[model samples]
Target chain A: GESVGLHLPTLSVQEGDNSIINCAYSNSASDYFIWYKQESGKGPQFIIDIRSNMDKRQGQRVTVLLNKTVKHLSLQIAATQPGDSAVYFCAETRMSGGGADGLTFGKGTHLIIQP
Target chain B: DAMVIQNPRYQVTQFGKPVTLSCSQTLNHNVMYWYQQKSSQAPKLLFHYYDKDFNNEADTPDNFQSRRPNTSFCFLDIRSPGLGDAAMYLCATSRGGLAGPRGFFGPGTRLTVL
Candidate 1:
């Protein structure tokens, strides 16, 4: 069965420090991966994504690393801020026919930022 | 700015009652999706409408239905609500397949079953 899982359920970091969230996927055929942040009452917000061909992709203050060989993905947040406190989720894109497909999300990791 | 929009941020329905959650996107995306999320859990894909085609996940219950009358609007209908069905429903839109294009999500609607 294809599934995505997180290494940790919760992570705590001080402001200005870096935070890393890890995820492992079972589907070797999955080619695209994404990281999302969800606030207390909001939907998941896109943070960053990485394709299988690319090992790493960087966004503002955030980076996504994908290891296809091990089927592992990680999201690194640099200089963590209080606003970064949220549940982080990793998703694998499943491609079906000729069109885009739905995403399979992993159990989220709660990131807590302390001042 | 163009974005995905969901109406009635909160909803309460009685058990066995029918309810519908609505979503609209101003981005004019070709693909629209509905996801269910419980407490401390990840969003689970329920169904989606690509253009005019409706695709449902295998695990999705027959009690759940969807309608995409046009490109900008999509709806999720629960034929009969259950206590276990209480969860946050999120709507998202994408211009292309999930592999390449970025998807935009709405704030989500919280459903309460009484």
Candidate 2:
């Protein structure tokens, strides 16, 4: 069966350095992708999104690159900070016969910033 | 201003007991969504309200039910929670603009079913 990453969660990054988080999708039809940052004891917050028509999208100090050829996605954060420490998740959505299909989420990456 | 608010940040309930999670959004968005996230996992969509129309995920269990009485408030009701029902419940809202509009999410409610 098609699936996403089934691996460890923890990722440690030095402050002021770049951090990259990766995700993979099982569905080939997914057209919209989103990255969310979830701090401890909080819900996931929207960070950035990229459409299927485009290969990459950038925001504030973050960039999301999509490789549709491999069904892979990555989120890059510049100058990692303690405030940026959190769990990051990537989700994908596509239109189906049942209205707008809900998003399918990757497991998650726990980003730890070392000051 | 906080766009979304969820009540009772932490809830503890006994098995087979009914539980209700409440969410309110000030964004006045036309779409509201509910997601269930277990420990160490990603948020899973339970259902959402596009305007007044409700849509439930096909894999969502029958024990979970959602109600969107208006544009601002959405509720998730667990008819009879089991130990496995313990998880974080998140509520999100988005303006019905296009398919990729960013969604605003509220601090989640952590449920513990014993």
Candidate 3:
């Protein structure tokens, strides 16, 4: 089955440095992608999203880069902070006709910040 | 603030016992979704309701069922829970169509089977 997957299961970065998380998706028909952050004992919180039509999108200190040709996506966070420690997941889904469908999430990458 | 709310953040049930988890949303979205997530894994979609129409996943188990009696409330019922069924159940809501649709998730309910 077509699925989204992450390149790394865990990442360790020092505070005040930049961090990057990578994801790859096999579904070419997917038109929308989102990045979510989940803290321990909490549900995922929306961070940013990018549509297939666009190549990149930025929000605050985070930037999402989408490469449709290679079916790859990456999230970069500048000046990583302690609060940035959490599990990050990338989800993809294609719109069904005029309605919507559930998102398919990747395995997720655990980002650990070193103080 | 308008958001999705799930009740009983933690629930404990015995094996083969029936349990129900509740979800409510103040966003008044047209679609509600139920997902199950185990430790160190991604969330798996079980089913969703678009308005009054119910859409179930092909691989969803028969022991799992959902009910949405109104626009604001939805429930997930597990008929015969087993040890493997212990996981975090998340409820999310979204407005239908292709206008930048995004799911708003609740805190989730952690179910434990004894």
Best by TM-score: 3
Off by over 4 Å in 3: A97-99
Worst 10 residues of 3 chain B by lDDT: B94-103
lDDT per residue, candidate 2, A10-108, as tens digits? 789999999999998878877788899999898888899998889988999999999999888999999998999999988887644233445678899
Name the candidate that leads on DockQ: 3
Q: In candidate 3, what are the lDDT values of residues B65-106, reduced to their tens digit? A: 999999999999999999999999999998978664578899
Residue B109 shift from truth in candidate 3, angstroms: 0.2
Q: RMSDs, each prediction?
A: 1.3, 2.1, 0.9
The residue ranges of model 1 lying beyond 4 angstroms of the native Cα positions read B97-101
**Model 2 global lDDT (CA atoms, 0 to 1):** 0.85
lDDT by residue (B62-107, candidate 1, tens digit) is: 9999999989899999999999999999999887754354568999
Question: Tens digit of lDDT per residue, candidate 1, span A44-95?
Answer: 9999888788999999999999988889999999999999999999999855
Provide the clash count, candidate 2: 0
Q: Is candidate 1 or candidate 2 better by TM-score?
A: 1
Tens-place lDDT per residue, model 2, B1-114, is 857999889999999999999999998887888989998888888988888888887888999998988888999999999999999999888775454445678999999988
Location of the lowest summed lDDT over 10 successive residues in candidate 2 chain B: B94-103
**Higher-scoring candidate on TM-score, 2 or 3:** 3
Clashing pairs in 1: A100-B97
| TM-score of model 1 vs. true structure | 0.97
